[model samples]
Target: MKSDMTKGNIAPILIKFMIPLFIGNLFQQFYNMVDTLIVSRFVGADAMAAVGATGTIMFLILGFANGLATGFTVLTSQSYGARDENRLRHSVANAIILAVIVTVITTFISVVSMKGILRIMNTPDNIFDYSYAYIITIAYGICASVFYNLGASILRAIGNSKVPLYFLMLSAGLNIVLDLVCIVGLDLKTFGAALATVVSQGISAILCFVYIYKKQHSIWPEKRDWHLEARDTSHQLRVGIPMALQFAITASGTMIMQAAINLYGSVAVASFSAASKLQSLITQGMPSIGQTMAAYAGQNFGAGKYDRLKGGVKNALIIMTVYSVVAAILSTSLLEPAMYLFFGSAENVAIQLPWAIPYIRFCAICYIPLSAIFIFRNMMQGCGFGFLPMMGGVVELVSRAIMAALSMKFMIYELASACDPAAWLTTGIFTFVAWLYVAPKIERMFSGRQKVID
Candidate 1:
């Protein structure tokens, strides 16, 4: 069901909305982690390395598509919060048109360039084929992933996060079954994992499209609204292009980091892969709160409720800090068992744990700063302060790139582990600066409102 977030208690609403989003993100991460889990255990370490090798590439390509879709939703969220039904419909229609364009362009470019991209990442010869197989399979299915992201973002924009969560649960469950069948039963290996993801995403996308078109009347576009206007399209691109570039820019840093890890050979690659997967599993709450803040801030911003917007941010930081401490504790306790589970042997554990454990520890304890970066950055994006957050992405890119380059000089793996924290710290500072700058401007909007009344 569609709910309006323009009114009501901000904290409770944010928590309620964030729970579903957090769970939904869990399923989404589970969707990817399952692939690595199955591949590592069933297919051998090389296969796991192959899958890991494509991680940054997938982020680079799919990240851009997902970013564009996410950017488009901000406009829809603002329109929904303001109760401008006409503008909401047009925003949805234009977003759909834009998604189509992005899907085609991204799929073609990523699929054709997969080999060269892998080479640039310094993927070792032994694992190159496995990585290529996985990347190509997923590349072909890029449209499915892009569509699902667009559909889900739109749903969340209208305060309908529950439906997307439901769909995601279904997709995650289905992908696991397929992973078992394809990777374990049929022995399709890396290709199988990628294929499972694509098929599951396609089903989720279809469900989202059906529900939005047939069920949700509030934000559905009519035939007349389907006609895209140059000005509106420009407006979306204005908001969306930066959002897209932000993700691409951030992914570039990760890609650089991955490239550095690649130079350490497959042992390092596989270790990083398993550790990163585990990190993603535990750290879902960080991004979930950030996403919830985005929607909450968007609605409050649209309604000219600047005070409520600040409340949302304050509550989110409190929640984020508490969760960060809890997650760090849990991660420290479970890190070893999780590693053993992922690799499944004392021998494999011995090899991977050295690199994986310290990296996870560095990341786990640093969640406070990490959470700040995501919340403040996304809050700005929600308030339609897209450019500053985009600049935060730039800060992430530069910081991570510097660390990745510097990690090459150090023999200690902790240097590499420190990269993310450094990036998060700098990015958090950038985002706070952005929030400080944007807050005054937003306050001035309310000032204008009071003057109008006077």
Candidate 2:
């Protein structure tokens, strides 16, 4: 809502902003992918599988928290655009207070239920220890994750994407260093990866707050700014809860999928994990444009610049759609080489390569429609229609459940029929199904409201 991403020379400005965001997000995935890469290379495929084991659960809780913060970011951006300093300050204070409580509660819940959560997912017997250790270690540091996201969202809200990107860059470098040292030098194994991530996130969060306090003129919060009314907190939760819940539901669906993956045995688990790691390397940049669109939509909508808001959405679609197609093409052509680089053992590589090819190709296509969903959610959230994003989440959850169930049945069918293509087909079919559900909704959101957004 702060920077007018829609107003400038569209091509040049989009390139400038989105490039940094794209690079930063790619590096962010590097923090994650490094774990799988190093562990698979060093600790054995089982250890890598252990790291993979935590993914859906981690995405579940972490996604919800980040989504909640993003909602606050959109709100703060609009408040700042309207030059309502008091509301911005209030938003910041309340966000901090709320995030702290949620972090603590989530930490307690996650830690206490770590084993149960893993059990529900039917995480492979061999990798259970690594999963538990990783989950517990990260949950213990949930406070750091919360702070980092809250701070980053604050920076983005006030049009300081570069600042958070800078902090994340710093954190990513630190993460790489720590990951290597922890696993290789310290021999902390899976725990080391979680520790490295937590420590890096904490440092970034702390640095972010310091930066916000000193330099963000519109966002500086005084002691008196800390008091929050129940209604306002509820209001933030109202806007934020659905976002958080959306992630939770998606994660739950993924957890089911994770259980299904585990049913396929260690080779299947390891192969799927390798592909997920590699694909994230390409697809993670979608959020940058999504967030950019959200900011543009929020600022203009707040200023009642409806025409610009409409134009901005069109601009975002053009930008993200092109990238998604390119990503799909690259993934299809390069899937084998990428697998060779990231995975291990002749058997492991062979098992993973085929599965990755079809899954990523489908993802590339999904990215096309999916990008529109992200842009629309952010746009809707920016326009103060926060609940639309929640509806999207529900759609995602339902589609995901259907996809996973069908995929599993397909997997079982393949087993019985001696059809090896079942796994890859399951993936491609699900990817298409997701896009099918998501694309129609995005088209509907803008079909009648085709006023150009700023």
lDDT of 1 by residue, 392-445 (tens): 889998988888888777755667666777788888888887898899999998
Model 2 C-alpha lDDT per residue in residues 332-441, reported as the tens digit of each score = 67777777766745665787765555555555556666666666666766666655566556555555566567667777522311111232233334433443454455
Worst 10 residues of 1 by lDDT: 409-418
Q: Which stretches of candidate 1 lie over 4 Å from their true place?
A: 449-454
TM-score of 2: 0.88
lDDT of each: 0.87, 0.72
The RMSD of every model to the true structure, in order and in angstroms, is: 1.4, 5.1
The total of clashing pairs for model 1 equals 0
Best by TM-score: 1
TM-score of each: 0.97, 0.88
